[model samples]
Target: MSLDVGAVSSSKNMGGFDESKEGAEKSGVQEVGDEKQGNVKRNMSDASMYATEDEEEDEEGNKIELGPQYTLKEQLEKDKDDESLRRWKEQLLGSVDISNVGETLEPEVKIISLSILSPDRSDIVLPIPENGKPKGLWFTLKEGCRYSLRFSFQVSNNIVSGLKYTNTVWKTGVKVDSTKEMIGTFSPQQEPYTHEMPEETTPSGFFARGSYSAKSKFLDDDNKCYLEINYTFDIRKDWAAT
Candidate 1:
């Protein structure tokens, strides 16, 4: 079965039509047996009968409304699992609003190198760790670590890159807000999800969100673009001893 994709964004007719019929009772001023004059026109189920109220079909069969189809956690979890998605998240992270805010991390590059063949087939070694700065360098590493690696990078009208990463088997790829935590391991696709859930149900998904991006542009020898990533992770207290 094909899964529905895309965000749920919609709008309702909050206001009325532009034309103003301030005092216009253009249509018949009243329904034959109604006391209210021309207030409304409703369709009646039986013979050519007109009702003077908005149709409120209490038993008009069942109406199915799909909404909030995916959760931020679901999206973030899928993003981490899919290589292509991780790239997009990293790109989105890169494009986050960065104006009028005191700088967070000093924008800088850790590695930049060009390929021998095309000069454009460059590779910047960028590794995002599980319990350290997922981006940027000079950050210390913690034991019991899991990480993602960007193997290669190329730049054009759009960016192209290769990637691979491992799951945090022992450290719980499943992360949640402080109050709630992953009590067990779960594979979203393994079993059927809840058939019917209340509206705005928080999705059970992964966290410890991290992203990485790399772009290559051919330039004179000294040309280079800095590459860095940022993430949050907890160090394994016992693993550090080993």
Candidate 2:
């Protein structure tokens, strides 16, 4: 089933994309207004936040060590005799039906949809192309307009570690902006997770209004890419006449 969480916002920063203002949720709907405005730049830079190799260095060249991981069933069986622990597990895992899962230890994540919300405009649900190719114009952003993006996805089997989002934009082959947000880990569940990004104001000015190429990616701590999209959008002097 599709979910509607309303319009959200995001900002750009000097580092790249601004850090996420809030955490993701397994369920719920949030409506955001379009009043706030500011210069957004890439914010967070904690390389330790993502899943690294058993031994690997972050951007700062610090070594990170990861231990063994447990599958959903294995985690559920833990402390099976502890009633309190069982109850807590039930609350944390929320609606995960182990009987329906297959014999795989690796977690599976499916990105369902991405919706763009703008003030005084209908939400634009961008299609997730199967081949990761440009189907056509993804969407157009009016110069100086306020908007946010909502991502809907599902995880299954084991737990997904360090799920994150990254976006990079370019104009005339010159890199303009890049963003990275840590979406946190998630347990397998029947209900899809919905994450609404922070609000952001599109760049305004004559030079900012033009066609651009962009790539959006969803990955986990293991650096395993789930979705990679190559698409095009426009920063227009005015909203498209459609």
Candidate 3:
């Protein structure tokens, strides 16, 4: 018995061997099916990932409370008699005008825009719907591409403590990744705050190209949810057509 060399070469060329696919195959990973290509519909599990974890304290295992929270007016008036301290407070609070603002108002944070940045390509800015609806197919990323998210937001009324961001991703009913990032505390100011997250590389090969659903939230230490977005994106063989 003998094997046909030409047949073996033809088969190898047709299948196209690559390190990613080789590992995926050995681990029982399969290519994304057609059913997984459709847009992910909204469900009850949108905020499930960060729901419980937000209650966890910081890494030092200490929940430090700096006395009671104060309103913007109260903070400004605490040391009004001292000219030097008043100047320092004014500089630290940016250009927020506390005269018209109510005395008991709480801090408010509004997310203005979100943009996706990829090397050698134009940024894809995603619009925030008025009613917080899940905008399906917000953007597409090429497999193995490096990308990052840029966020623009405004704070008003007071200071928001321990601001943070959380993102959870899922594919085909399975949780694929989860990320938690501390954005730091923010004070009310005239200009919006812009933050760009550290870059991340998407998975490659056949099993990695497919539609994914994600839940992203911006919250603070007080458990106040500033913004929560449920969106879907695609990881394709190449960058999507603009």
Best by TM-score: 2
Q: What TM-score goes with each of the models?
A: 0.16, 0.71, 0.68
Tens digits of per-residue lDDT, candidate 1, 1-242, equal 21111101111100111111111111111111121111122332332122111322221242223222233234345548689867655443333333321132112122222111112223223343434344442222222232212222222211111111111111222111110011111111211111110111111123222221211211111122223222333322222221
Q: What C-alpha lDDT values do all the predictions have?
A: 0.22, 0.63, 0.58
Worst 10 residues of 1 by lDDT: 177-186
How much is 6 displaced in model 2, in angstroms? Answer: 18
Question: Each candidate: RMSD to true structure?
Answer: 28.3, 8.2, 18.2
- Looking at model 1, the pairs that clash are 109-226, 135-229, 135-230, 136-229
Lowest lDDT block of 10, candidate 2: 26-35
Clashing pairs in 3: none
For model 2, residues 1-242, the per-residue Cα lDDT tens digits are 43322212334311122333322321211112212223333444564234232322132342223455566677678799999887766665666777776345788889988888889488887888899876778888888888888778988887676666767666666555555555656667677878776577787898878887777778676666789888889888888876
lDDT for 4 in candidate 3 is 12
Ranking by TM-score: 2, 3, 1
lDDT of 3 by residue, 1-242 (tens): 11211110000000111111110111111111100111122333444433443342342343344457778788778889999877766665655677755375477989888887779589988888766555568778888877777777887877776566666666665565554455555566667777665465777899988887766777666657888777778888998897
Model 1, residue 231: distance off in Å is 49
- Total clashing residue pairs per candidate? 4, 15, 0
* Candidate with better TM-score, 1 vs 3: 3
